[model samples]
Target: MKITFTLDTIDKAAEEILSQCQYKTLLFYGEMGAGKTTLIKSLTKALGITQTTGSPTFGIVNIYEGNGETIHHFDMYRLKKEEEAFDIGFEEYLTSPYWNFIEWPEKVSSLLPTNTTKINLKILDHTTRLCTIDNGSNELK
Candidate 1:
């Protein structure tokens, strides 16, 4: 599903994304300042996460608890190579039942599951942004 929303309506947009996304593993794609973390904050809130959400840019991954489940949020931007993922046990996380939210997934593209959900964000203006959420099949339904 695709949505165009402003900051004021971001909560609603987050709800729409949750309704459309079918996978627990999600890949977020966008350029810097495109609101990837902003949208994720809304999404985690929708999932019942109560703590303050922050980007995992430095730590690589941050774990959040919500709805009696664990969410693994990853930022692979700083990794010099895909092998760094394995150094950090990326495979173990991928095989777990918890929700996985990956930013800059292209950095570990070779290791991503085929069924992952892909969310693309585009900055249209200072206040408006467009999002397209699709299953990794390359078909947006």
Candidate 2:
């Protein structure tokens, strides 16, 4: 699925993505200031998470729970190597039956699962963003 949206319509974009998603793990790919974290926040809210969300740059991962669901949000930008992900029990998290939204997923690409969903975001302008979704098939849907 492809979507062009702005901050004003982010929630709807998030909803559309979730409705089309086929997996619980979402790998977010984008550059700095591309609104990856911003979109994840909207996603979590759409998933019924009531708590505030933010990037876990320093902490690596943040777990949120609400509406009978658990979400693990990961920020892998600060990781120096794939080993760092293992040190934080990243593999265990991936096996869980909860949602996993990862930012900077390229930082730990080798460690990512094969069945995950990928979301690519591009900044078209200061307020507009173009989002492309790929379900690990090497082709955008």
Candidate 3:
């Protein structure tokens, strides 16, 4: 599925789309200033999450308590090597029940799940974005 939006409507559109796909590992792909974090925030909010969430660039990972599950938000931009990801137990986090939203996943490309839902965000203009969802997903309640 592909969706286009301006920055102002991206959040709402993301929320609706994410709600249709429940409890799936989400990969956010985009360049700098592409509104990846903003989309994650919208997803969390749409999933009944009330806690605040920000980029995990510095902390590496931030956990949020949703209604009954954990939201593991990760930033691998600072990761230096594959060993570093293992040192931080990336596998454990990925396999866990927590809803993991990863940023800069290219740093640890080998570990990303093949069946993952990839959210590719492209910058059209300063405020416009093109998001493509190509995860073989079916509509869900």
Which order, best to worst by TM-score?
2, 1, 3
- How high is the CA lDDT of each candidate model? 0.89, 0.92, 0.79
Clashes of each: 0, 1, 0
RMSD of 2: 1.6
lDDT (10s digit) by residue, model 1, range 31-117: 999999998898899889998889999999999996797889999999999999998799999999998999999899888888888
Between the candidate structures 1 and 3, which one is better when assessed by lDDT? 1
Across 1-141, the per-residue lDDT of candidate 3 in tens digits comes to: 778888678667877568555447787789988988988888787777899889999888888886886788888889888678887788999888778898887777788776567788899998888887756432111
Give candidate 2's error at residue 31 in angstroms. 0.6
Stretches of candidate 1 above 4 Å error? 138-141
Listing every candidate in turn, what is its Cα RMSD in Å to the true structure after a full C-alpha superposition?
1.8, 1.6, 4.0
Ranking by lDDT: 2, 1, 3
Please provide the root mean square deviation of candidate 3 (C-alpha atoms, Å): 4.0
Question: Candidate 2 lDDT, tens digit per residue, 1-141?
Answer: 789999999999999999889999999988899999999999999999999999999999999999998999999999888789998899999999999999988888777788889899999999999998888752334
lDDT of 2 at 87: 86
- Evaluate model 3: give its TM-score: 0.88
Q: Please provide TM-scores, in order, for all candidate models, with all chains considered together.
A: 0.94, 0.96, 0.88
